[model samples]
Target: MIDGLVGGRLYGEAQIRTGQNGKRFVTCKVRATTNDGDTIFVNVIAFDDEVQTALLALSDADSVALSGALTPKVWTDKNGLIKPAVDMVAHKVLVGYRGES
Candidate 1:
């Protein structure tokens, strides 16, 4: 799992994109805060079509809970640099509005 948060806070938006080959993918960057107020950034990705559509419907600043596995992807960039990416394969998703608690 890629079940962590990214950005500067717990709230953020997920981005969905379709490749030229018609492959769909969803990415979410969330900001996770530690108990001490420290923050970490995480990037989550969903490749399943159904999950992608669901994630795409989520708007910015929405609160979402996701469960998934972690996957590492590596590729070479056009500048001849190797890039490594870690993503999540979301299996469960819960969407909630702000202050829903």
Candidate 2:
């Protein structure tokens, strides 16, 4: 597992779900742009109470930065092209206040 920080815009609204063990957690996707203009999606999950609360307050397209464990992944697109992605177990969440007065 790679520990890193990723900043991006929320791809969709975060979801809260319960596990079979009766534990609740949050999950969300972030669309991050590469320096070369490519877009990579990060699947994020947070179990910490603070992180979960911060994610739940965010909306789609909201800017956020997260720090935690990252796992590299690859997925095939509709055109059969393989794209890279990351799965993050986020421990910290930072929501950007851009465009807010």
Candidate 3:
């Protein structure tokens, strides 16, 4: 039931890594600015090959729009420190090119 505006510049390029099952996983960070002038950062992960490919093509300044659920993850680091994190499970992605209305 998590929903909100999720779109912004690619803070960094998408990185592909191998998962436990040997499948490829892609992850990236986005910097979004809200109407209230609040800037927020979000991490996005894509499991689908096509989606992953599309995400990787985006440059650092590229704009993208996505709609999806926000899921929080909690874990303990090797040093036994507890960490909490959150990311978006994108259902749609729209690439914005320069000068495009």
Candidate 4:
């Protein structure tokens, strides 16, 4: 597990799910660009109330930055292409300004 920050656009609208213990959490996917010009997907889950609220308010493709625990992973696409990915236990969520000037 690595502690770091990731910035990207939300791949889809965030979803809320209830745990087996009846606890609710938010989950979302972020598509980040790698240094090598590749795309890396990050699966983010937020348990904190503030983080969850921030994530739930954003729409698909919204710019976002998150800080938390990151776990590197590899996933295979439908075409059998291997892609890099990460699982993030997000503790903080940063969103772009939404209010009018």
Task: Assess each prediction's global lDDT (C-alpha) against the native.
Answer: 0.62, 0.96, 0.78, 0.95
Model 4 lDDT tens row, 24-90: 9999999999898888999999999999999998999999999999999999999999988999999
Give per-residue CA lDDT, model 1, range 1-101, as digits (tens): 34443223234677768879988777876555556775444467778776676667777655566667766666567999776544556766666544555
lDDT of 2 by residue, 1-101 (tens): 89999999999899999999999999999999999999999999999999999999998999999999999999999999999999999999888655766
Q: Which residues of candidate 4, in runs, are more than 4 Å off?
A: none
Q: Count of backbone clashes for each model?
A: 7, 0, 0, 0
On TM-score, the stronger of 1 and 3 is 3
The reply for model 3, stretches above 4 Å from the true place, is 1-5, 72-86, 97-101
Worst lDDT run of 10 residues, candidate 4, spans 92-101
The TM-score of candidate 2 is: 0.94
Q: Model 1: which residue pairs collide?
A: 1-69, 1-70, 5-30, 6-30, 6-31, 6-42, 7-30
TM-scores vs. true structure, each candidate:
0.58, 0.94, 0.74, 0.96
lDDT of 3 by residue, 47-73 (tens): 877778778888887888877778766
Between which residue pairs do clashes occur in model 2? none
